[model samples]
Target: MIKKRTRIVCVTLICSLLLPIQSASVKAADNNGSELSEEISSLADFEAVDELIEQRVDAMTDGDMSEYHELTEELEAHGCEDVSAQEVQELTGETSQGLLNSQIQSRNNISVQTKGLYSAAASNVTFSKSITNVSYGGKSYKVMKITASPKGRGTLFNTGSVTQKYNSSIKAGSLNLLKIVAKKAGSASNVIKLVSLYDTVCSVIRGFKSTTKVEGVEANYTWTVEEICSFIYVYDARVKNYRISASYNKAKYVVSMNLPYLKVKNGKSYSGITHKQYSDWISAQNYGKTDKAISCFKQGTTYNSWVYNVSMTGCKGKNIKNVYLQHPESAMTLGYWN
Candidate 1:
């Protein structure tokens, strides 16, 4: 009788142990089934979203308005309403509008609206905590939601908007527009103004006295043909057809004129002249009492009769020397006299 009682107690203990194990196994199976269903549902949603995005991308490429609208509607139905494929392209840094300045203004407006929506809808999205259940289709569906910070939202909006502007500005020939706007926004200390001075110079030079490019360093500022012509007259000691030079004498600046500009000039050239006449004419010139002018004329006498005549006759009352006329030419060389 005692043996029979011991067997009953042992059997009861064994069944009690097996019962918890069976219950645990069933609970684990249920958890696994829930996880599988959630994964499948999430994957299906992702596929739908991806397919819709692809269709919209295609529609946009084809410029099909109706198809684009349908794709947008489908995305809206899937809880992504404001995300445009075109906007996405801009945001992703793939491309931008053709005009940068206009694009910058437009992007700012879009960013403001997008930030407002993102801020307003953030509470509906999940946070850092794990989400065990999601409400969808009148049934509890497991979902995970992520929320972004205001700073992050601001960053996203700013980066996307500026990138669009930058790319568009490049297309519009406003290469430094970003730096300019950044200065306006107080985000940057320096503002750059990009003026294609080459274009300006080219335009100016095109109307100059010469078609061949001028032989000199380009000016930092823009210039008109007249201003440039004056510059050549004033600073270009190498210019032909014009007598110009600078000299200092007795601590006073003197623009000695050797050319007969107003007929009040006094310089001596031999009355009857040949090559020896040219050399004698230059040697007798008394335009300035300076040793340099005497030396210049003496050295200049060796040039041909054309140069000698230009120096002696053409530059009679001008602050120029005979050797100065022998300098290189930009326009057609004022042909030498026979």
Candidate 2:
């Protein structure tokens, strides 16, 4: 029989010795850096959490899942929290809700609860000693709980539309889109089946502009557009190779996967309105006359065999109409409104 405390200490010591280099392979700049060669996002936070996991085998009853929930609670006690898939799911798990000034429409579709997102805000550990039974291989080992000091991780699990990618994957909210990016980098079979997993629900919140017009005269609509889109790209930059590498500014790959809201101001709608192939009418209720500004949901159109979301809403603001637009693979790609 092994002394639980003794075995845990020995393993920790050995692992510590094996990983001699405690720092990151490449020293990344602060996450706030605006230049291409700067900012590595939340790797540091993840790394810290990882290190804690390595040390605190006792607290990982259910592995990262357990630790994530427990640690988030502790972090909240310190006025900070880590936002991940789990967090997003917990905070906005219901049909739809508002969170942190933004409307979390659903799973991956976050309706804008706040305007300026590409923005800021998560932390801490208390020093304590306790030996708990940590299970491994269906057996229990006694280990000490090791907690991280939040002071060291002066980082936040934030939201916004900044280009945040890691190891060739673009991440937004809880979405990690490496395979989709890889496809653009020129690979035949996609590692990602984004086309399979998600049913992208694209909506519009048009106030200033009109959505895609149908082939006929004028179709009044109130419906949701659902599409299965694979990634086709558009970029603000003129890069010959969209593939991210050390040669390119990784920070410049700001492909936001967050659900986008097409904001238009009253009388300041987009100069052009797109034409859609089909429009599904879910609501037969089109009030006869000038009553009030309400919700609009238009169907979608197909381009290159892929569907794009289109919308129409009753809001008078040519700028902001509440209509749902197109579906993406839920992967982010830049496109011109045209």
Candidate 3:
């Protein structure tokens, strides 16, 4: 009986110890579950914050000013006190306010017009000119103007006028014209004249020289024009006579000479003269068919240049003087041909 009693007491003590251990395991499991739930909630909160930020960025990009402002305010209200206009710009690349400001500024400063028409007449030929203001990429430009004058003596005697406004960018080499009708004396019939003009921009010529060997003879050419801009005036006198003249500004010398009249099948056409005819005339002037150089004075410093070998014609002879190089339809004007 004593053995049985001892056995029962030992079993009861084991049961009591086991109860606390089991209870502790159950409590640990519950704690682990609570931590897991909190982590999941944090992840969800982070996702919500990311989504809000994306929405705000979209609003700014879409130019939804109202929504953009609202989203910014919401971010500040939601514990993002540092949220600011600049911060939004950083996130969205641009702000609605900035775009609006630019639009307003552009609208206010928009001014476009044809400055005026200027003409110089000599030998029954009239060259009418005008400049148009063009806006592009938030900047304004004064582009060259080309207008057609009338044909024959009547149109030459009358005033040539041109007035135009352009909104698009004017590219180099683009042609524009002014149309006129020539009324002959004692005749009721009138002829239509189409005058063509080209645009060229002059570049500063630093230092350039070249030498070539032709038929075992060495021909050397050098440049002497600097810091000047050149403009071209090509006048079409019907189909029989086409003249090319140049004007220079910010220059020390003047250009005074009309190129030899080019005979064109259609004088009204832009490129009136055939290439062969034009080259032949230049070659006959004793100018080498290699390179043409123009020399001029600017600010006490002589500038020499040969813009392009447009036509392989350079001044000849050892004492090459009074030579002018010009890039037809180009800004590179070399000599004074008045």
Candidate 4:
């Protein structure tokens, strides 16, 4: 009976020890679950901060000093000041960002035109570790702070408008519009007149062939600046009686061709010239006119260019044939005549 009683007591002791151990295990599990929940909550805070930072960056200017204050405040609030504006610029300009096999590029998911929060799972942006300086509205913000997680992840929020200032500096210039034209004559050898706005030739239209028919006559020719000028010089030589009336405006240059007392095959010889030949001649001359006009460009004109047009009537097909040449020069060079 004593042995039985001792065995019962030992069994009870064992049961009592096991009860405490089981309770301790349950408590540990509960603590672990709580920690996981806190981590999730921190992640939520991170996402909210990311959204807010993007909003202010899109609204600020990079060149303005005040922009930096806005960015710094945002960065401080979000925990991303590992680098500054100056640092970012310097790093970007580096030969290789001073790292072995490193690459830098804007995240594909990031919208270049708009600001938005980025989630780590969704974000594609990455950059090397570096220090940076930023000037905005007129001040610089130094290395404020840096944050890291036990995990190999980090976030940098430049809360100020200084980032925007940098962006604005990249967009400083403007564009202007221009037009050009060329004309040639009835006899292919006739002088090609280029009526243009400025004197300097920015560009030229070469190996151009335009065709048109006036009821029954056909005309064609290769058009270029050099050829057009050469045609004009030829016409001045062949027809001493020929006269040119030209004028220009800010937007257009017009040349009205009028050669009087010509020997028309018949007064009806106007029909023999054909509309196509006249149009071809006018087109050839317009290119030369454009070259000449380009030379007149002044300080403000340097950026502006020309739209040129050339037209003529009362010239014969014999005259047109002489004006059109197979190849006028080896390589067409504009402004060479000047």
Better model by lDDT, 1 or 4?
1
For 94-151, candidate 1 gives per-residue lDDT tens digits of: 1222222333365474453433333332232111111122233464322221111111
User: Relative to the true structure, how large is the alpha-carbon lDDT of every model?
Assistant: 0.22, 0.22, 0.24, 0.22
- How far residue 335's Cα lies from its native spot in candidate 1, in Å, is 69
Model 3 scores what on Cα lDDT?
A: 0.24
Scored by Cα lDDT, where does model 1 land?
A: 0.22
lDDT of 1 at 288: 18
After superposition, the stretches of candidate 3 with alpha carbons farther than 4 Å from their true spots are 1-121, 142-338
All candidates: CA RMSD (Å): 39.9, 24.4, 36.6, 35.6
Question: Could you give candidate 2's per-residue lDDT for residues 249-268 as a string of tens digits?
Answer: 00001111332121122222
What does the lDDT read for residue 113 in candidate 3? 17
Best by the lDDT measure: 3
lDDT of 4 by residue, 1-338 (tens): 24633543455456446432121000001211221111111101222223333332323212343654564454443334333323322322212222111211332442422122212311222111211222333643111111111111112111111000010111111100012223323223333343211111112212111221111112223212111111111001122211111211111122222211111121221212211111122223233232332223211131111223222211121121111111111101110110
Q: Which 10-residue window of candidate 3 scores lowest in summed lDDT?
A: 35-44
Output the better candidate (2/3) by lDDT: 3
